[model samples]
Target: MEPMGLRERKKLATRRTLQHEALRLAIEHGSENVTVDDIAAAANVSTRTFFNYFSSKEEAIIGDGPPRPTADATAVFVANGPTGDLLDDLKHFILSPMLDLSAEELGYTFTDFLARKQLMLRESHLVTRMMATFAATEREVVAGVAARLGEEPEAIRPQIVAALGMTALRFALRHLHHHGDTAEGAGAEGARAAEIAELRDLLDEAFDALRQTFDTAR
Candidate 1:
């Protein structure tokens, strides 16, 4: 990776600040209620500058999130580290960058929103939109990974693996969000590391059980 100059670093910091403010405002006021002007004011950036960073208010709240990588970036990230095993590669590909989120970031974005949505599932539209975006982006990521590995992108197993991994991730996120803490509770996403671990373990166990059932049928 090329070293970022001071100017570039400053730009990124400003962008992050803007996104954070946008998210905070959206959580407080609802996504539709938080306007670009509001985010720009909160971040101390002009509305024009806010437009330079994000195309829409929703983008500001989502803030180039981990699950939605651009095609080129996803290709590069997938190709950089190639493990021979497909499952391990899938897990690494999906989970690595996610590990970078600060505890506060997770709390603000996910953990705090879990319970109300769990009971009401009122954010189904938001969830659907995010999942669709994630699926489309992740398909590109897997295609790049498959190309690098000399596997056909249309091959059944690879497609199935990608789909299953995505499902597990969404499930984990919803589980953590709904059950970890209500929007009013403390500890937020910071204290849910253990829960995350357990969710991952459950995914593995579920996969193992499916494998055994297939073996028995075969």
Candidate 2:
């Protein structure tokens, strides 16, 4: 990867500051009570600058930047041919973006959120906010799955698979946040690794259950 230029580094720093500040302010006050202007003020950036990075306060609060699959993941999806197990491929495609995250990056995002009791207390509200952000990503995943299967994006099968994949991901994330890393023996890195492993296990269980349900119904 190319090194980040000074300008890009500055932009990233500013965006991180805005995101951290936005979450802090939203947690201190209710999300409904916080405005973009308030977040910009807290971050010491102009409201215009905040808008340049994020369209709304919720985006800053979620703090994952944008919902986008990495280039390699996208390439893998596009290059995939008929594997006969569309559902399994769909699951892999859906999770590919997360697979690209480095261990440190995963810990920074998922583990940090899991550690925050305040965030957990507002689970419903946070989930609602995250859903809005996830909508576009869902569409993208659907398109990718459809393309891989030589079907239209609007096809019912692809749509259902995409939705189920996303639901599974959300369920796994929530479960991890609540039940992961409770052991006192594990260090922080160990805990994070365990959490990730548990997440994969949860996803596998969910998909297996789904497959079983379909088979039983048939």
Q: Give the candidate number with the greatest TM-score.
A: 2
Tens-place lDDT digits, model 2, residues 1-218: 35569999799779877877877787788778899999999988899999999988877887762236655666676677234476676666666665656554555556445533366477456776656666778888888878776799989977887889888877776677532344466655566567667777888888888899999999
Please tell me which predicted candidate would have the highest lDDT against the true structure.
2
> Where in model 2 is the C-alpha error above 4 Å?
1-13, 35-38, 62-67, 81-84, 111-129, 178-189
Badly placed stretches (over 4 Å) of model 1 are 1-8, 67-83, 100-120, 123-125, 154-156, 177-199
Sequence-dependent TM-score of model 2: 0.76
**Stretch of 10 with least lDDT, candidate 2:** 111-120
lDDT of 1 by residue, 135-211 (tens): 67567656856665667888876677677767666655555522344433646563446445655665565556556
Residue 25 in model 2: lDDT: 80
Give the true-structure RMSD of model 2: 3.9
Estimate candidate 2's alpha-carbon lDDT, on a 0 to 1 scale.
0.71
Give the local distance difference test score of model 1.
0.62
